[model samples]
Target: MNDNFENLFENSEYSKTIKKGQLIEASVIEITDDHAVLNAGLKSESFVGLNQFKNPGGEIEIEVGDSVKVVIEEIENGDGTTRLSRQKAKNETTWSNIIRAMNEDEIIEGHIQTRVKGGFTVLIDQINAFLPGSLVDVRPVRDTQYLEGTVSEFKIIKAERKTNNIVVSRKGALQGDSLENKSEIISKLTEGQIIEGIVKNLTDYGAFIDLGGLDGLLHITDIAWKKIKHPSEILSMADKVKVKIISIDREKFRVSLGLKQLDEDPWKKIISNYEIGNKIDCMISNITDYGLFVEIEEGIEGLVHVSEINWTNSNPNPYKIANIGDQVTVMILDIDNEKRRVSLGIKQCKDNPWDSFANNNNIGDKITGKIKSITDFGIFVELDGEIDGLIHISDISWNNEDNIDLSQYKKSDEIESSILAIEAKRQRISLGIKQLNKDVFMEFNQSNSKGSIVKGIISEVDEKNALVLIENEIKGILNISEVSRDKVEDMRTVFKQNDEIEAKIIGSDKKNRTLKLSIKAKEEKEEREAIDSYKADEKESISKTSLGELLKSKFKKD
Candidate 1:
């Protein structure tokens, strides 16, 4: 009874010594899927959650008889059992290490677990630490999702043991590491050292590759000989790639890498493979508003400008001309090796319609086509061979040159026209609808000569002259002074509109393409012709009478 009382008193003393939240070492006595029983010199074994005994991969890491540190959350609750937490014990130790790191300015390893408000929560030695957005990297990073679940080094910037608050800066750690190894990495790098690296970050202009101790830039242009707008097109974060060191700027600590430098430059063989004016078949790879990019070969593309897509139409739509992946024939207009550019022409591969039309047709030849478009200035007619001919308003009719009625001509109206001009070099075809019929002026000129009398109706009368519509389609002007060789004050008084008048074509005025007619000259010419005819008849009668008298005398003498 005496030994039992002593044992109870010793047990009470041990229980008093075991305070709540005190981290203590314990040995695992039994372990199951849900709980682990640990003995920590207590009245009863404490049960620990089996989940806390698991490693990061979720496998149970502790077994029976293994010593593990645990924290006592409750020494004695309503029941007789003691509650213990394995994770809390680990966190306490980790917090102490974090505080030491902050005081000593030391770097530690961490795993970015998830994104939280204003920053991320990083797991450092089983304790959650705050990582601000600004301190995630040495430079600002818009996308930090790639860092999730990734292990990185960080420096403890702030730590509070009472509140269990810890803050870390990955940028500080990264900057320190870079400065320590930058000189060593730069020393070994040569002008053309081929090395392997991981794609650390991507930007529009290039990608930064992690070369063990430093970051090297792989420009978009050096990614491939062909064009790429962004580095993300070919590379992703953490992708391993082999590149050649193109250049090194040790003063600025910048390294330039090139992926294409490993391969032979295809442009070096361009002279043997291609030349200017060389016709070849290609596939359209891309289409833009300005032009189409055609793939000549691997890593080589040539631009076919909109102007070079067709022969007749200037500034044709690239989408209408061809689509992506369409096979087309193009002529190599130029090959600039120095610039690594090629000027290709789609129109040069086909026959020029202007040259073809000029060779097949001539001026004054009648052409039949449907009017494609009608405007006030002209009519664009769709002629043979998909060519277009323009009939200006002035060439639409014979007499309505000044005032034209566009309502008469409609789109898709079939009409017959004569080719007035064909400028092959300019790729212009001038058509005339009026030229298909006989010209009124030419008809009058061919039928009548100078001084010929012609009859016409006065269509318009003014003080200066009377406008006569000769032959319905031809117009002539008769001035007031030439009306009757008399002083004519007003032409309207002498010649009324719609009145029949006879006039002589005294001369031609080619400036206005009109004939100068005179009524006085016509009347005078008629009088002179009548007098001359009378005199000729009288002479013939007198000669006949003289001959008869001489013959009668001769007959009487005989």
Candidate 2:
């Protein structure tokens, strides 16, 4: 009995030695409504709140005889019960685990609870840890509200047990994972390798793609076979796309991706698909000041220049004739495989007006039309089929003395003309109004000949010559040398307009329609006739009288 009493005193001494803030391993002995009795190697039984042994969902987490870690808050109280806490013990263990994770470079899982001034409060095993805004992700997070209630792994970068300060980074953990993924991707990457990626960002020149954890570039030109103004036209942010690796630079860590490479190059079979002078229907994809871009097929386009829009209309504006998304017929004017250029013509698909007019008519064929426009040099007549023929100013009238007033002939005036020439290549048609009637110069040549005496009135008197009108229609000229058989200084002084005169034609050119008249020839002919008359009268008188009587009569008269 004495040995038992000595052991009891030893147990009491041990309970007195138990101090506050001490972590001790204990086993749950009994459970009640409000308290859990625990055996912690102390003389007296310790009690912990039953709430500490329950999970957040109000279920019992610890049963009887279950091992638990706790802190001694009091050794001996007035009620002779040892006070203990389970939360303090859990906090101490969490700090120890965090320090070990930091030393081992391990990642810890945490839930973002709330936002703070410069960072977010994350609950790591019931202990609050700081997550800076800059380190939330690999990229900047514009909205932190999305992170609430999200559980993510993080790396403990800063830890101070005394101050209870801990800082964690989600970006650091992501970068660590990226390094491992990047190495594997780089080793396996090769040209012409097909892969899938997400569109991360966009720029003017290209788009950045996230291939797993690696970033690659998809240039604007490589997005599609056709032209694109920006990357957003073909792709949007966070869109999943399949691409082909066109090139790779390991030293610079750059990868060039292409979406068009997976499909066939349209230019490879362009020559076989199209040919010169072949007609085909196309859709207008784009319009510019110089031309229209026509789509022959998907990713295949041809240029229809402004010059090729029509045959008759020069300087055709593309905007006035067609707009975007219009269907039109075109003929392939040219094809260049090396340059990947196809020249198309909208006019070639239609019948050429000049060729049609030339084939139906011949020179000197008379046709009637209305004057469409008038210029200083000529008038444009619109004939059948909307074709225009030009009548030059010189061909408008037959009389050289009269100048036709073009202003008198207004637009839409009906006029008759004869086709003179047709230039199919130049798309020009020449018409003459004078050709509708017989040529007056031809008739003049048939009636008059050289050295013929003609009488007419002077129509024009100049220093060089005196123009005379014969038959009131034909014109003749009297040179200065032929004016009255004298050396005249000026023909105008000797003759005036409308003066009636008789002259002999000295020269005539039927082809050139020129008549040369001389007054000197007429005067010389009259003199010769008078001399012949006098000789005849003298001869008759001599025959009637004798030589002696004739001489005596002549001497008496003298």
Candidate 3:
């Protein structure tokens, strides 16, 4: 019984030699290549790293047989040796110091090693801590690259032993500075005061002005006397600007400032210097659809409407009359000091051409002019002044083969035209050089009667009728009735404009300027009847079919 008891006691004593995570006082017994054997007052010596022999300062403080507290990291494994950690025990003491510093709310000095996504990692003693970028400085920093390798003071905002995380805020320290700066700024700040300040930050709508210690909002609207598109247009980061304090909120420490108020208003002094009907020279600033905006003085602009540009022209383009940067003299038609607007006129600065034209011309005076334009029914001629006269096609001739060729006349063509009529109230004049010549019908009246046969060219052909121009002042109309006694197909295929043909004048009225001529009627009676029958059949065929069916038939043939 005694031997069995001794055997159990021996086994129990062997088992009590060492265990994992056991705190023990140990002595450095021997040093090897990478590890050291420490005597922990047990039967087995524990193995520790060689690096544990030296302090963080690179000094080997522990000597052989020197005692130190150690933590058992592992028990014997396959190699049969106990693992020990001296540094782990020393870390416990460091943690205690950190906790004490945190509780006391003390500022810790640390070196920032590397940057992470949101912040930089700082080495505080033997621990890794996070220093957020927002808390890095007194103001927000755009680039955090300069923080690497920099040593800074921070207050521990969060620390946890289990998680091994410590969050330090340099912003809290910066906030202290901001408060001090703010106090300094407010000491000298007041409403209705102007001072210089640095632009700290720019927002989409405005900028925050740093007036030494406090930040005041400088709205984009207040930054310029004129309209601005964005806050960045006038203010940029760190820009020094003169600002006027418009208001202050003592409770919230809010400040309102204006930048444009420093400049003098030009409108206030502009009206006193100028008056209506005064002619002033100015440069065309901008041309718009409605008018032209001209700058008459510095910061003072006026409008010259399209109607005011030229009295004689209608629907005149502002671009044609006034180009950008063109120097022009204008008369001030009206001015409204309260509305800050000046009405200007370009034509008022010059003489009215129409007024002078009306005074010089009358309805009956015969004058020579040049042909300006020719239309289907009349010829327009430019008279002695800027006036234009129209001679109707009816007045061009009194008989066939005596009609004038107006197409031979062109714009600015020099010719002799008679002044047939004029209306000054309506600002119109009637001129006819053709009428001044001997009347063709009266000259031929004695020889050719109402049934006279004449030869002329087909000067104009239309869907309705054809016109024959003969003598220099005579024209005859061949109506659709004359083109065909009954019906006719496409006129394009039969006769084109300017074709010459012979036609008998069936009737004439000299006073009313009317003439009747015919071509198909001059054909044989049988041929005319056959053509009329064919035309009637073609018209009936077209009327019977829908347009879509006709087009489909045509497309199919193609």
Candidate 4:
């Protein structure tokens, strides 16, 4: 009994020394409707509110004999017990662990609990730590929602022990890889090194190639020798391509790539297979204004110029002559391997007509022809064969002007002409019809003076004149004024055509082949005098007859 009393007095002294607001470890003894009795030694038994121990649904979170660390607030409330809180004790322990982690700059492993605007919340040991958006990935992640519930390594970027705040960086891990992996890939890449890569991203100028652990730029210009409008025309994302490294910068880890250099140049083998004057068949691959380009073989092209299609005819428009897919045979006239030019021709396959014409005909020969066509300058007359001649307007007639209408001479009019000139090289023949007739004026001028008299038949008559065909070839115009000098009012009354009359040449123009004739003055004067003499004789004879009759009658009466 003495030991029990000593123990009670000792406990009372310890409880008096333990003040309110002191932390104590206690076990829940009993749970009632509104309170839970907790045993905290040396202090009085603590009563925790049921609101703190029970969940909102009225179920007890802490059962009897469950040890809990709590804070005491009241010593007695008419029940010789103290008030305690378990939630406050748990909050203090959570804050103490978070503050220690922040001060040491330690990365605490956590699960992503939820997401925020710029980042996600990581539950690190029941403390929410901020993982920024930029620090979420080694590169960059567009959607943070994908990162929720995903575990990754990160570095602590911001930490404050006082505020218990922490921030982590995943980008720092990505930057560290650049310094370590970039040099390793570059040094192993040599010139002419063939490597496999994946097309990561496509751009207008180039593509970003991922060479396993490193990245290299693949420029669009190096994709192919042939023209490509865009990078997507040749490459696409995630496409596997084998590329040869042309150059490498070990310091910067830059690589230059070439796809075409792996193959042989097609032009090098093209020169040996063909030569000039080689008659080859080719397809018309392209049609241009100046020529048609033909592909004789793969990557080997030759040009057939517009002039070389047919030498006889001017180049027809390409649409009329050849289509896009037409196959043609062209003669190779020239080949220059160094210049990469092949000149071809179509006319070289046929015999030239001008060369054949030069061998057949000569000048000054008589050619019988029929008028085939007429132009402004001359008439085209075709001979028996394919031969034709031109009779210029000046060579048609000696007394005729070139302005004379030629429609009267229709096609198939037979005419004899002397071949004036023959240009066989030029494939031309010049003929003259007037040369077939004797030049009477030329002959007359050579034999006689300019004023010599000439006689001919009047062959043509007009309103005020007549044309005398002097010696069949030469002609002279008899104007109405020159035909009579007796004030002849009209031309038809005085002189009749085809009458056998003679006249002197008052004037002559040998070069012009013209003569002037007159008959009115002498013929009119002689006619008047003869008429007067006849009238006088008739009157005298009548008087004599009357006198004789009177004498005869008197003699009969005696």
Tell me, by TM-score, which candidate is best.
1
Report the candidate with higher TM-score, 1 versus 2. 1
Candidate 1 residue-wise lDDT, 133-227, digit = tens = 98899899999999999999997766766767788889968887555477888899998899999876565678878787577889999998878
Q: Could you tell me the TM-score of candidate 1? A: 0.63
- The 0-to-1 C-alpha lDDT of every candidate, in the order given, reads 0.85, 0.84, 0.74, 0.70
Q: Which parts of model 2 are misplaced by more than 4 Å?
A: 1-185, 267-277, 458-467, 477-481, 486-499, 507-516, 526-558
- Work out candidate 3's RMSD over C-alphas: 26.6
- Between prediction 1 and prediction 4, the one with superior TM-score is 1
* Model 2 error, position 187 (Å): 2.6
Tens digits of per-residue lDDT, candidate 2, 54-138, equal 7645888998999999999887688866788998998889888887766444688888898999989999878999998988989
TM-score of each: 0.63, 0.60, 0.43, 0.44
Candidate 4, residues 1-558, lDDT tens digits: the string is: 256754684578665676677777888888888888887774356667777765434667788889888876766657745677776666566556554433332334566768887788876545567887876766666666766876665544444446667666555444554556767778788999888898755556676676765667778877864445678888976799988888887776678787666676666765777777778888887888888888877656788898888745546566579987788988989988778778998777766554554455456667677898988778999864355779998888775454467787888889789878877556677898878887777676566454455566767666577777666365667777766664656556655677445444556665566776555433454567688888889989999999999999989997
1 against 4, candidate with superior lDDT: 1
Model 1 off-target regions past 4 Å?
1-175, 178-180, 457-472, 488-500, 509-514, 524-558
Give me candidate 2's TM-score against the actual structure.
0.60
Clashing pairs counted in every model = 0, 0, 17, 0
* Candidate 3 residue spans exceeding 4 A from truth: 1-136, 139-192, 199-238, 245-260, 312-325, 377-406, 418-558
RMSD for each of the candidates: 23.6, 28.7, 26.6, 32.5
